[model samples]
Target: MGIFERYAPFVQDYIYRNRWENLRAIQVASANAIFNTDDNVLLSASTASGKTEAAFFPIITLFAENPPTSVGCLYIGPLKALINDQFMRLTDLCDQAGIPVWHWHGDVAQTHKSRLMKRPSGILQITPESLEALLLHKHAAIPKLFGDLRFVVIDEIHSLLRGDRGGQTLCLIERLGRLAGVNPRRIGLSATIGEPARTGELLSSGTGRRTIIPKIDAKGVKWRLSMEHFYMKEEDSESEAADIDALPVLEEKTDTAPANADPGLGYIFEHTAGKKCLVFSNSREECEAVTSTLRQYCELRNEPDRFLIHHGNLSSSYRETAEEVMKDDAQCMTTVTTSTLELGIDIGRLERAFQIDAPWTVSSFLQRMGRTGRRELPPEMWFVMREDEPDARALLPATIPWKLLQGIAIVQLYMEERWVEPPRLDRLPYSLLYHQTMATLASTGEMAPRNLAEKVLSLSYFHRVSQDDYKVLLKHLLKHEHLQKTEQGGLIIGLNGEKIINSYKFYGVFKENEEYTVRCETQELGTIVSPPPIGEKIAIAGHVWTVLDVDHKRHLVYCEQVKGKIPAYFGLCAGDLHTRIVQRMRGVLQEDRSYPYLMKNAVKRLETARIAARNGGMDVNPLVNLGGNMWCLTPWIGTYPFITLERILRLKCAESLGLRNLDTARPFYMQFNMDADEEGFFEILRAELAKDIEPLELIYPNELPLFHKYDEYLPPELVCKGFAHGVLDVEEVRNTVARWG
Candidate 1:
């Protein structure tokens, strides 16, 4: 029988209702993998390629065939918005079949969750944090809720592949299985996974079952792409105010919003009017800035405000409103968002997507692009790169438009090689170890130290963690009162440990700053890490608000709308970039062939940058000498390696090369003042690297770097060990530098 013949009647009706002429390729593959095999499955396909239904149709059929006594499926999503979206979608498909769908998260109503607990059946959708909470608070009820769980579907699994949260999810599944005495089949779903085989391994890490990534014929997409570059002001010989494209980026335009506006914003504004779109920003600050700027443009142009804002800091009401607006086919609006919207939420009929700057990775680039082009349309994205005009006497490195070049390189990487970033599986993850250990103790009350070690260490995520390192952590925790030794020679949650585990934030392994809720007369704008004084204005929700009161006791900021502009203050967000991207960026400058996506202004900008790069001989030399004792080194390595190189220059090679006043532009270049010439600098770098040095040598004497969320709570020795052994990629740096010699 065909795949359609295998699906339950309800799914067939739903597919027929949606007017699907034939089963998608993914549907057939997923049915064969799930219906015919007992192994785990990984569904890696393009966005909106029927991946969700592909996995669900067969699973639902199996559920209908022999109903389990408890919830038959556990659906884990990375975001509340995603769960909510899927909850609605699944409800529509499953209601006719009498399958109850329950979504649990911070935003979910408790009454609905209580109903699920009272009679848990059908599918339960939850986030990892919520799942963590479930495992912690309702440890005994796990069997009652999911004793017969037959499947565990992780949506957007690529988002969790490289982080502590991914490890946490794996641990949660394993712990739940042990508690419930069942090994549910695992299935992963994503549109941007690079290495499916390795990802399959990650998916099936704890489960003894092998993971099946079925072979599907890859289909080519005709992407509608354009990239433009604009300076904050036109000071260069080429004016940015002119026509920016040889061919209009958008085939059709709505009414012009602003004639004399910031060219980049104007370009976005002109194209987005009367159309449904998403404007993605790299940061919440930029999202707010772009929203307010575009709203102000509308007011100046005497048009109705049609722009919306959505980010993690925004209240659920605000974010949900934006989501609803985008989901409605009739409503036309533009929502400026961060990575929060980049995941797989079905925002219907999105005409285009605009990126304010280059995204951090190739995976991100693909995800943002995937937001559109649904319903058989071409994937469409317009990249808008903006920077301040270079000063007349600016350093040669400063003259290059890095964002523009980086954006182009990101596009080329996917265009030429169809390459996406693979998961970095070599991390020590000591911080996660600390988190899972405390969680296990809290959930189980008390256990022998050996049993505790076994439970925690047996997790595949912690294989890289050594017993000595864990011992050091337990000793430190005991010293700090985060743990206590029971009279039975067991480990238990101590007073300090209880305080850490009691908070809602402890359920998550990701880092979070102290946030204060911002309110304006019954409406919640959002949360901010730090609030300005009682009178100073803060920016959020696409508008500025003056702080009326700061209730430190309650962690609330009462505010009133004001007319001004202020940058939103969030804590420092570390950069995550691959070395290959930086290397591709250098190659972008050297290439003579023009990218077809470059707009006229972007073309001119690239020409200017290439001229400047050639004159400095940067196309050939990784080392460039500025006037006087100033020099810059472009290592073309990834983030961790770049950080390692910085430490090596300051801590190891500084004395030999007389390096001082060091600074960096991330994976791009490191500029400093040094007494040694280019040849001498290379000699010193080569000599230091030639020694039998380890990643530990990159650290300064007595310096303890806290790089992870739980690093602060770890022992100093363990923290140093984790940073040196897990975080730094010294071998990659050495390999790249060897070619330079």
Candidate 2:
């Protein structure tokens, strides 16, 4: 039978109601893969291509013919927002077939979850962290809840592949399967993923099934892209050169945008007015700052506030308000957001997306750009790269306009190669190992050490962990009283460990800071780390708030709305860029090829940067001399390798080269004082790199907590080992230096 004919009656009715002239490529391919192959399936297609219905339609059809006694399908999402959105959509589709749909997340109501726990016979959608909680707290009820589970669908599967959270998800699935006594077929979904075959293997790991990735043709479509560079109107820049001149402005002139408004933000304000749009920032701090600045523009321009804020730090109410407002076709607004809104949320008819700075990865750029261009419009992205006007005496490193280069490189790499970053599947995830070990003991009550090792170590995600290293971890945990030994030579959670695993924060594998919830009277604004004292101002929710009182006991900050500007303190955001992107940045500077997406301001900025680089001889050599006994080296590599090289130069070759007072712009360039010249510097680096170097040599003695969340709890020896083996890329460092020859 044809794909549509194979669908159950309700699915057909829904399709007809939507007036789909035919099944999309993803839908047809998903049906064939699910029906013809016994293996797992990976569905990759463009956004708004009905990938959700594509996977659910075939699975729901089978459930109708022969519904399992327990929850038949498990859908795991990366975020609570996604589960909430998909729950409403999937509920409508499965309603007619008599299959109930349930969603479980922190924001979900307890009564809703209690209903599912009692009956437990339909589709249950949940986040990975919630699933982890279910596996632990409901250990006895697992068999009853999912004993007949047939399929496990991981949505936005690419988001989970690179970090400890992804490893935790894999371990949870395997642990759940063992408890429930059923090996469900896995289905992975994504709009932007790299190497489907390799990612497919990850999806099928521990499931005893290979993955079937259907090939689908992606049609060529035009994109609306423009990148502009700007310095704040109040600041002076060195761009007034003989060659650099602005072309005629293309964006609509904002006559009332305030004469002295920041140029980049003004451009965003001009375009986002009277439209449904998303302004994506790389960090929550940036998100808050952008939102607050844009709202001030509304006040200055005598216009209504047309912007909303969405991010992880925002309270559920605040974030949900943005989500709901964007869904209404009548509501014309823009959400200044972080990665929280970059994922697959079906905000209707988004007009355009504006990025304040370059995102860290191509995946993020694609995902943010993909949020728009739905509803028969092309995907549109406007990059507004802002930088402080460099001082005349500012070093060459500061004058090169790294953000502009990075942004151009991100676009060119994807446009030419059609490539995304491959998954870093190999990792010694000792932090996750520690977490899972504690969770297993707490859930199982008591287990022999050998059995515990077998259980935790056997997880496919822990393939890189060794038995000796596990033993070392156990010894450390015992010494620290995180794990207590029993009379029968078994292990259990110690009193100290109970303090950890007993809390909600323990469920997440990612690192987080202790934060206090901010409240204005009875309404909660969001969360902030290390709140300022009374009478101090903090920025959040697109406005400034002054701290009226601090409730340390309840971890709440009482505040009132106030006006002014201040950066929010949200801890640190780590960036790990790919090496190829850096290489492309170098290519952009050396080659004369122009990007059609570059706005006039960006074109002039690129020309000025190219002139500066050529005069400094940066086009030929990676090293440039700033002055006597001072030099800068552009590594042109990714984050990890850059870090590794920094350590190598400081620790290994510093004394020989008289390198001291080191400084870095990270992943772009490094500067330090050295006794040697350009040739001597290269010779010294080549000699140091040619030697037999151990990963441990690159690690600093004082930096143990730099690796992962649980590393500080581990023994220093094991922390060093994990940091060396997993975090450092010495081989890439060697290759980078070899290219210098």
Candidate 3:
């Protein structure tokens, strides 16, 4: 039978009712493979390309023909918000066909879960962490819950492809299949997959099935993109030649709020008025600041606050309220959010997206931009690049508009070559290994240590883990009473292990906050971590505040609201600039090509930076003298290589070259004082680079660099090895030295 002919009557009716001219190419291809072949499927297409419908249509039709005895489909999502959004969508579609859809997450109602438990059927949407809890708490119900599971759909599969969370999801699927005695076909969905073949292999791991990636012949999409630069203050632009007045100033309507507020925030507020929009920031603190600033503007104009905030730290009620507001077709609201809203959460039709600054990777850029342009209208993004104008004596690196160049480079890279950041598979995931070992024992009740080791270590993510290394971990766990020898001579969860496993935090694989709630006179203003001493000033909710008192025991801080701006620091956030972007950033300095996205101020800034780079001989040499025996080195490599290069210079060549007071502005440039000439420095570096040294040579004997969260408990030797092999890009460092040669 043809693909559409294989569909049940209800699916056809829904398609016809929606006036879909024909099945999307992806849907047709997916149906043919799913119906005719028993192999897995990997559908990779752009946003709003009907990938979800493509995967589900075939499965639903098959279910209709042969209804299973229990819940027949398990849809896994990386984020709880994504699961909730998909749950509603799938429920709406399935209900019309008399099929039930149930979701299980922390935010989900217990009543709906009880209903599913009483009579499990249709589709069950869940997050990986929630799935872990289910397997732990309802161990015996596995068979009855998914006895005849036909499909396992993993949405946003790209997000999980890199980390142990992805590995955990795969392990859970395999374990569930083994326990339920049903091996379901797997289907993966993503909008930003870098290596299709590798990710396909990952999706079908242990399934003994090949994954079919449907080729999408989609036309190029038109983007309403623009990038503009702004200084924090007009007087700060003494060194920069960018004429602020030359930039196009979007005129504000009289009905809109005053323009004296933060011009960037004002622009966003005015543009987003009477429309649904998403204002994306890089961090939670930024999200809070943006939301609070926009609300303040609304209050100043006597306008209703149409702004809402969504992030990982916010309470469920607050996040859900923002999500629901965005979803409401009648309400005109905008949400200020972090990456929590960046995934495939269906928030109805959004007018546009605003990015506070450039994202770290092309994949992140695509995901954030994809949040808009849903339900038809083309995707649009306005990038607001904010920085303090460089001083007269500012160095070479400071003169360059890194964020603007980065934003342009991201767009051009994807536009010209369709390149996205690839999955990083080679990492020592010891932290996650610790998490899985505890979870596995907790789920399975008890098992012999040999059997336990065999099962957990056999997973593909653990292929690099040695038996000796695992034994060390086991010994440590035993010493700490996290695992104990049972009467049956097997390993079981011990006292400490029980405490770790029983907590809700154990469900998640990502880093978490030791969060403290922020309040002002009993009204909560969200959360902060490691609050300052009483009467100390802090910045949050877009304004400064002084802590009147602190309840450290209860993790609460009482602050009276104040004014003015201050940097809000919660934790460390690092950026991973791709090699291509850094190289293009160099091009931005070397070439005089003008980008259409650059506004007047940005264009002038670029011109000034290019002149500085040329005059400083940045194109001809990696190192330049900055007078008085001080020098600067520009090495435009990514993060890992940057780390390695810095260490190699300091440890191996610094003393011989008489280098001192070496400092860096990260992946961009390094400044130092050197007595020896540049040629002498190069000779030393080249000699060290030519030597075939062990990875351990990169670290000092006493150094125990703790990079990962759980590295503190690991043996120092293993930790160093992991850091050297997994974290440092030695090849890039070698190449940098070769350039000097």
Candidate 4:
């Protein structure tokens, strides 16, 4: 029978009601794989392409024919917002079939959870942290909750592949399978995953089943893409023969700029007016700033606020309000958001998306762009690249528009090579190992050290972690009282460890800061890190507020709405870009090829940068002479290798090359003063790499170098080992330098 014919009656009825032209190629392939094969399946397609239905239709059909006694399917999402969005989509599809679809997360109601606990059946959707909580708190109820689980579907799987959270998810799935005594088939979903075959192996890490990735024809997607550039100061526009004036001006670009107003934000405000859109920022701090600026625009125009803010720091009520308003077709508004809204949340007919700057990765760019084009319109994105004008005597690297080149490179890399960052599965993940060890002991109570070691180290995600290293960790933990030895040769949570495991915040594997809750009377406004003194102003939820009172003991700040602008502090947020993107960025500067998507300002900016790059011979040499003793080096590599080079220069080759006063711009370029010439600098680097150089040698003495959340708790030796082995790409750096000859 055809796949469509085999769908359950309710699925078929739903498809008919929605008036699908025919079963999409993805849906048909998903059905064939699920119905004919015993292996796990991966459904890869673009956003708004009915990928949800593709995977669920066949799984639901089987459930209807032979429903399991317990929950049949477990859908794991990276974000609570994604689960909440899918909850509505699945509810409508499963209602007619009398199948229950439940969501479990911190924000979910306790009554709904209690109902599922009493009679667990149908589908249960949850986040990884919630699942971790479930395994730790409800250890005895595992069998009753998911004993008959048949399928595990992970959405937006790409987002989970690069961090400790992803490793935690894999560990949870394996642990749950062992506890429930069931081996469920797995299904992975994503729109912007790079290497499907490799990622498929990760999705089925311990399932003992080969992954079946169906080959689907790439869909033709029309994008309404535009890019514009701006100088941070208005006076800079008139100084250097403005590139923006080289081409025909756009109505959006020609908008009058207020002397004190940010021109780029003004452009966004002007275009997003009277439309339902999403303004994406890379960080929570940037999200707050953008939202504040847009609201100020509304006030200046004598119009009511038309923007909302969403980020991880915001309270559930504040975030949910934005989600609800965006989902209402009648509500014409825009939300200034961070990666929290970049997931597959159904926000109902979004007209367009405005990205304040280029996202860190191609996957992020695709996800942000996918927010639009849900209702038969082409996916649209307006890229606004903003930077300060270079000084007249600025270094050569400073003259290049790095963001503009990076943005173009991201677009071209995807369009030309279909390149997206693959999974970084090589990390030792010692932090997660420490966390899992603690969690296993906490959940299982006291157990023999050997048995505890066997259980935690046996997890597939911990394969890279050695038994010797784990022993070292255990010894350190015992010495520090993070783990206590039992009276009968077993291990248990110690006093220090108990304090950590007992806290509600212990559930997450991501980094977090001690934040104070901002409140105005009874309504909670979100959170801010390190509140200022009383009477100072802070910005959040798109409005400025003055601190009326500070209760440090309770971690609460009582504030009232006020007018002004101030930067929000939410701790540090870092980005790890791929090396390919940086390499492509160099290519953008070296070549004269013009992109079709560049707006007037972007096109002019590219021309200017190319000219500057060629004039300084930066397109040919990696090192450029800034002046007498100072030089600039453009590594043109991603985060890991960039870090490796930085360390190598300082630790191994610095004294030989007489390197002094080294200043770095992260993954882009670095400037420093040296006694030797350009050739001498290269010679020192090459000779250093030729020797027996260990990555661990670059780590400074007594430096813990805490990168992950739980790294602070790990032994300094293990932290150094993890950073050297997992965090640095010394090999890539060596290879690049060798080729430099």
Candidate 5:
């Protein structure tokens, strides 16, 4: 009986008022797998590792020894600032066990959701777009608010294991367990899960149960890791210009210099001043240009701005006032965020996090180094990287510093294979099957069409969606009425699918953009994307405003604060990377190892990109040439098989290797002008990949490539068959062109 004596005595007096002398091998293997099995647990430790009190102290000691008649733990969090940081750590461990710790989203408060729909017992916390607006407007109070629900948990279950909001949180936990018949028992938490038995079968998918993942030994963390390198300047050398592999690459630009003197925002404003940091920035326009260059280096050292600025386009009172001044442990402040403060947001003693550049995953560099060591410390991060100074004649792949060799191949693929990125579970999501078949026909309205294809094709994330591609997506959503057909044959929600399910952004399934909001007098500064004239200025959460008034039918903008710098937009920042982190950044420029947290200009820019990848052979040719009928290639592969080998060289081996002017820098290197050579260009890409080709014949003529977010209300032949069969990988570009013949 020693899992802290099976928890409940107010979870062992809240783990002895947080002293926790023992129990934490993930809270004694999550209280011996939720008090010895009814299966489905999965804790997967690390990130201030008491994985939410190891799945809530044995599911709140089985809800204080069998007490549920209603709401007995549901939780779910993928940010409403991690459900307001686990609702103040589950309201100080369920207010000494009288329980009742609710929370709902869109910044809660509808009279605290009519006092949790009038007495819905302990633990609710939400947000899969507020549990798809509580199963679409509290559809008959989900069996009196979760009947006798016995534990759902979820929280950052590796950011809902790959997209369409993790298949709309597994179709809202299988339509809230068949509308509250209640199955519950699933747990799943994470620090940065790669494959805990495939995300514990995506957290017990239809909860039949069988997921236990508790191998917790966890204690060795220690990572105050570093990496540095900046440039935006110093040039002239690769024998100064004149077609040195035809120049043009130079990058690093925060308007190239002087925002309190650049050197990577003055080394992230000198190690984020008196600490309690976070910095981050991988776009909300570099989190408002690194919070307006670290608040102009606190107004050029007159001090006091101590920075702050979160992202996802700000405003929810400027991201809950930078999440209440970083959970104010006497606010030494830092913020400058994006990836919205990475995730499991506790934000208290966070003494360091920085990042600034290289984070396009190893699960976002272990969730921004799990926001900073938290209490038993050792989880810090640093990174920074930056670029620019190249183009003298810049060639060997532009004097490679590709974000400091992609941050040393994302820290040597998690220090030599403790890898992270998993759960893509083969796509063909067909835009989350047209958003769960128009949210199961707007929450089961006029059903029938074989009960709307057995409630949206028996949703186990649409089992790779096929009932003949959902009967050609229900005959093109009833020939574009977005689903109408009724007269009792049924399948309702029409008039353009009730203006796309009566917006509140139709309870999200990701991808948004069309924002505006912004404001200034009476503060709101948080959303921007094409809202520039009535005065024109705009930035966000980090200074510069000006605009004054441009209602455009209440999309709003009205701004005022104003000063200098500008660039900030709310859209487009895509990055994919993973072909095992671009083949471990081409084996960190063909190895010569030496990475004890780099520095000294990232170990002299990774020993000059390993002597320009050994004099441009790029570690033995992925083709190079670059003079006459040009060349380049360098596959190393990722971003959708480098967009399926640039549409198999512009739709089938470019006019038989005369391959004219191709051009690409995506998923790294392409440049063209072929006229065949290297073994007649891999024998014309193995005879046009041996004929019968079809990734929709490398899609072209009248391309409708609207990649996801309900692919522009689908039906452009199911958005070109969900971008030619669930976003092109063309068998990882035909197994890297079958090892180039």
Candidate 6:
């Protein structure tokens, strides 16, 4: 039969009802693979190009034709919001076909989950963390829950391909297959997969099956892109000083709005007035600040608040309200969000998206921008760059508008080559190993130490972990009472381990803070950590609140609404700037080229920076002498290499060169005092580069660098090895030093 005829009736009916003129290329290709082949499938296509339906239509058809004896399919996603969205979409389609669709996540109702448990049939969509909980709490129900599972659908597969979370997902799938005694075909779905071969390999890691990545021809996509830059103040620029004085008085755009508002916030307020949009910030703190500022603008204007906020830290009610408001066809609302909404969540018919600054990767930019242009409209994005105006004696680097150039680089990279960040597979994932070890012991009843090590280390992610290293970890666990030795000489979860595993927080592999729930007279205002004393103010829920009372024992706080601005506190957030972005930033300083995406203020700033760079001779020399033997080195590498080079100089070559007083501006430049002359410096660096030294030499002796949350509990040596082999880009730094020769 043809692809259309192979759709098992209901899919064809749904297609006909929707009046789709023809099946999307992904759908046509996926139909053939899922219908004809027994192999797993990896479907890569652009956003809103029918990838979700493409993966599901064929799987549903198969389920309809040969219904499983138990739950038929398991859909996994990285984000709870994405899973919820997909559940709604699939539930609508399956309602007509008499196939039950269920979602299991934190936000989902327990009643719905209880129903699923009662029947244990149809599709079960869940996140990895929730799956971890399921495997632990319902160990004996695994076979009954998924005995005849036919397929496992992993959505936004690219997001899970690069980190321990991905490893955890793969491990969960492998464990599930073993426990249920069913080998389900895996289906991977993604809008951005830079390296298909690597992703295919990831998809079929322990499945003992090959993945078929269908080749689909996609047409060109249209985009409405614009970038604008703003100084924090008008008088900060010399040329704009007169214009600033001559311009009209700064009046409140709305009567109730606060006077003297932030220019960038005002600009966003004006642009997103009546449109359904997403304002994206890089961190949760920024997301909260932006939401508060926008809502303040609405209050000042005497208008109904049209702004909503979404992030990982927010309560589920708040996030779901935002999601539902954004989806409502009648409501014109804008949501200020972080990456919580960046994945493939179907929020119907968004008009535009606004990015506060440049994202770290081209993949992130694409994902943020892809949130819009659904429902057959061209994607539209506005880049808003805000920075403090440079002082009269501003240095070369400060004057160069990094965010503007970053936006241009992201666009150009995609426009020219369709480049996305590739997966980083070669890492010693010790953190995840620790998590999986705990999870394995908690899920299973008891096992001998040798048997546990053999089972856990044999997994694909822990392939590099040696038995000796595992022995060390086990010894530590025993010493700390994380595991107990029974009379039979088998390992079982102990009291300390029970305390760690029983907490809901242990379900997630990622880091989390100990948050106190905030409320105002029974009205919840989300969560906060380390709230100030009573009567002190904080911003949350797009409004300021003053602490009324503190209940530390219950981990709750009572607050009353107030009107003011204060910085909100979340945990730390760090950025990883790629080497390519830093290189392009250097080009922006050296080359006299204008990018089309740059707005008026950004254009002027770039020109000024170029002049300064030329005068400073930054283009001609990587190292410049300040006075005597004092010199500064400008190496435009990114964060990882910068870290590696710093260590290589301090630990590997410092004694030979008599280097001291080293100060760095992270991936940009370093200034140091050295006794070695220019020629001597080069000679020492060359000799050091030529020698073969272990990468572990850079690790400080007796230092346990606890990067990931779980690293503190791991063996110190294992943590050091993980940092050396995985965190540091030693090879990149070596290549850079070789260029100096």
lDDT, candidate 2, at 635: 83
| Candidate 3 vs. true structure, TM-score | 0.93
Residue lDDT tens for model 1, 259-322: 5577678778888878899999998888888898899899888899999999999999999999
Model 4 TM-score relative to the real fold: 0.97
Model 3, CA-based lDDT: 0.81
> Model 4: how far is 415 from its true place, Å?
0.9
lDDT tens per residue, model 2, 1-741 = 899999999999999998989988999999998978889999988888889998999999999999989999999999999999999999999999999999998988899999998999889999989998998899999999999999999999999988998889999989999999999999999988888888999999998899988888989867788888898654423222111112333444433355677777777877777789999998889899889988999998788899999999999999999999999979889999999998899999898898887998988898998999898987888888998888889888888989899999998888899888888887788889999999888888899999999999999999888899999999989988999998888898988888899999889988888899999999999999999999999999999999999999889999999888889879878799899999999999998867878876788889988989999978768999988888989989999889899999988988988899999888899989988788878888899899989998777868674568777788888888888878789999999889775
Query: Candidate 5 at residue 529, lDDT?
Result: 75
| lDDT for each residue of candidate 3 in 156-275, tens digit (9 for 90 to 100) | 999887666787798789878877999899999999999888888888888888998888888778776777677755532212211222344444443454655665566577678887
Cα lDDT tens digits for candidate 6, 386-473: 8887887754556656677677777777877888878778888888888889999999979999889988998877778888889988
Number of colliding residue pairs in each model: 1, 0, 0, 0, 2, 4
TM-scores of all models?
Answer: 0.97, 0.97, 0.93, 0.97, 0.36, 0.94
lDDT of 5 by residue, 510-568 (tens): 88888988777777767787798888787788888889788888798888886788787
Q: How many backbone clashes does candidate 5 have?
A: 2
Scanning candidate 3 in windows of ten residues, the lowest lDDT window is: 236-245
Q: CA lDDT, every prediction?
A: 0.88, 0.88, 0.81, 0.88, 0.78, 0.82
Listing every candidate in turn, what is its Cα RMSD in Å to the true structure after a full C-alpha superposition? 1.9, 2.6, 3.3, 2.5, 24.7, 3.9
Residue 300, model 1, lDDT: 87
| Model 2 Cα shift for residue 647 (angstroms) | 0.8
Q: Which structure is stronger by TM-score: 2 or 3?
A: 2
Any runs in candidate 2 off by more than 4 Å, and if so which? 233-251
TM-score of 6: 0.94
Q: In candidate 6, residue 193 scores what lDDT? A: 87
Mind giving the per-residue lDDT tens digits that candidate 4 earns over 1-741? Answer: 888889999999999999887988888899999999989998988888888999999999999999989999999999988998899999999999999999999999899999999999999999999998999999999999989999999999999999999999989999999999998999999998988998999988899999999888967887778778888674533211122213333234333324467868877776776789999888888888888887887777678888999999999999999999999989889999999999899898998888877899999999999999998887888888999889988878889998888898998999898889998899989999999999888988998889989999999999888889999999999998989997888899999999999987888899899999999999899999999999999999989999999999999999999898888879867788899999999999988778777766777889999999999888878898888898888888998999999999998888898889999988999999999997788888888888877889989767788988899999999999999989888899989887774
